[model samples]
Target: MANVLEPYLYLQEQHGFGQNKKSSAPGEEGSDGKRDGEESSDEDNQAPKEENDDNEDEDGKSGSSSSDDDSEDPELAKLLRENSESPSSSDNDEQPRSQPADTERKGKGRFIHQEYDSPAGNISILMIACWTMRFPVMYMDFVRLIEAYELPYLDSLRLLPPSLTLHLTKQNIQALSPHFAPTPMHMHRLTSRLAKLMFRSYNILTPECNAAPLLWRAVRGLQGNPTLYTLTKQLAHTLSLTLTIHYSLAPKLKKLKTRDPEHHKYDNAPPEVSLAATVIVVLKLVYGLDGRKRTPKDIHDPACALPNLSEYLIAIKELEERERKSKTSILSASSTSSALDMDNDMLDDYLDFCEKALLPRENRNIEHGVIRDYFPLTRHSSTPDEGVRSEVFEDSLPDAMSAVRIHENSSDLGPGNAYAIYHTQDVLGSLPEDYEKIVNRAATWAGVEEDYVCGVVERFERRLAGWWDKVRREKAETLGRVDDEVCRICIGQLIQHD
Candidate 1:
């Protein structure tokens, strides 16, 4: 009782309990005297009989009113009461609103890029495996096998050591060669066509050069055969302007003098002037206006001179007039028509030159007295510029020049200082007799000479049989020298000489 009374007394002293201020609870008004009076009156009206009953009722009312005063207002209390009410247990199992699929989470299951460490020794081994066997028969067999096996074996094989990958790739190519023979003539035509296509592809001017190396390699490979090179070179000379323009190798009306400054054509001419001027001079020569009238008797090169020089000069004069007018109305409709007509004429002349050699017929030949200026023609066989010719031909030729011989001059075979690493009795001695027959048959089918193939196989067998013996015989320092030599040879072998 004391403790309870003490707390009540503290509240009364601290907060004026009897004479109320604002009531804090729900359904209760701010209490000055009015609210207290109203509460008392309500209690009085309820049941007033005995003094003891009245006291008990008043005390009960006071406690109830205080509790009520501590609670929220009715509106707020109603809201909170509704919120506090627990949702039905069944609501826990209710379905929710549909959600969008998580694309990023779903996409994580795809392939990833991984790097593998490779040693220089491994790279050297791979270089030998792939390139030393130049168009080796194993390559053809492997390619054919891929057709049979698909890429499953191949993808897995490359994932192995790099040398193994190279060996497998070579085998694949060798196998596929029969299926894709690519005859020399057809290859030539294909390369020429591809070169023309590359000339037209705008991608060359773009930032990416992905296709250039491929195109260049194909063309180089096609040109590897000599006959193809001759055909293209001849085409270049006779129809120089037209062909260059056709391939867009030369800009229209742009001069192209030789890079050599001492050449007569390059005397103080503006950079743009040489290319166009050279083309014009060549064209003039082709048209018989280079101070020479080639008659039908001049049948050595008919494509050079068609009509007489005067007629060609007159035509050029007319073309020059059109060129002058083109500058004023460039890119306009009229100028465009004139330009097209001129291009068409040039193309026609170029085509005629290509179809027939520039030689006149016997009937048009000059009698002993015909006074025509003699123009000495240089033989096409001789290269005018040795430096340029060598560079260009070296890139295209199948044979290497003496200066650039890529293959190391192998000394007459020194004693084959053969050494084996793995144990032999465990590997070779245990092989069944049938293995030789299988290997022999495979080698035969792959186009290797039986004796040579057998030699390599026997060498391998020997290595397996006497591995420990060989290892014991060779000192570690000597082995190091041998390894260094092997590496140099392997690297040297990769150079494509031809």
Candidate 2:
């Protein structure tokens, strides 16, 4: 909750509001027009370095520094310096941080600074409690309701009970989908919240499975009012993006491999459904899709300028191509061995194809590494035979590739033929690997061939992780500063002091 409130101040700052003026007693503004000995704590809430906790001397204070008689403002500076001196100021500096530890709770999982924290808001505290659960009873109930009511329309009607309907409506639909009916503000909020809860629950609560699509239908029905169609489209597009990733990661042919196949069908873990949920949450948080677009549907419609569909598709393609190249070399190497070693090799080939066809090929810049998250399926798999596995992209191939191959293999060709083509020298029967091999060799005749395009993926992974962490930290810090200001205002309202 503190994390959420922190952003309010950021918005205010963005809108050009200066920090709040310090409040003082009636006579405090004195001859110099500055309050003497005013205590101003620095608001750098970056978590403190751990090493500073043990050394009192290095803590932000010079204990022996005494002020001259006329230096009335020195004490305030002293306090600031003292606070800065403390190594653990962020977490444990509220009071004497190095006092003998409270032993009774030490072995029972107690934190050191629990007693010195400032009072927190009751509402915010409740939100914290809710967030802590990750998936709570209410969320589970919602999921159960969604799963039970299977059809799209049926799930919509049943899921929005009267109590839940408090926030249900058509107007809120403007937030995510312009094609949706003009739902009541309340209904829209309820649907949006419910959708979010279900998505989180599906992804974080249960193992990846088929039950996801049922929930998606409920998501789709939220667009009943035609007015929310754009919201629906945006929602669907985002959802598809997410599903594309989920499908890419999920295990292939789960039904054939598992004993309890019924429990994990597409209905249970449909990539599309999960993706839709992902779309809903991301669009809501990052793009403010509903608020900005309102009733607009087109890219230039002015509610908000969304990325062109062409751009998104292009991004998807480029991501796939990188994945294909990364895995193609490995599959080619393995293909030369034997037919019995075909499953693994064929799986890799099919995945390579899916990555190629599904993702957009044009690359403006791959450095952004936005595609990594979606292409996590092709990450190098670690196996005992390091040589064979080393060549494979981090056993990270997406689950959807497996599903597509399974469907194709099961429906049309026998497993042997299916597996054969996947690893066979002939792809589509039109292009022979023998012909392509000579061409590839001829193309690269000038220089000795390098084995693997080493560390390209690893470099991208590192860059992506760093970028993500930076974004999260910066965003969180900005919001933290905002909340601090709000807290200062609240504290002022509660007390009357000089």
C-alpha RMSD of each candidate structure in angstroms = 30.8, 36.3
Estimate, for each residue in 10-58, the C-alpha lDDT of model 1 and write its tens digit: 6554334444222132323323334455444544323222333335334
Local accuracy by lDDT, each model: 0.32, 0.32
Predicted candidate 2 versus true structure: per-residue lDDT over 427-483, tens digit per residue: 344423332332223112111121111111122223334444554566557677545
Tell me the lDDT of candidate 1. 0.32
TM-score, per-candidate, Cα-based: 0.17, 0.15
Q: What value of lDDT does candidate 2 attain over all alpha carbons?
A: 0.32
Model 2 Cα shift for residue 132 (angstroms): 13
Q: What stretches of model 1 exceed 4 Å from their correct place?
A: 1-154, 157-229, 236-498
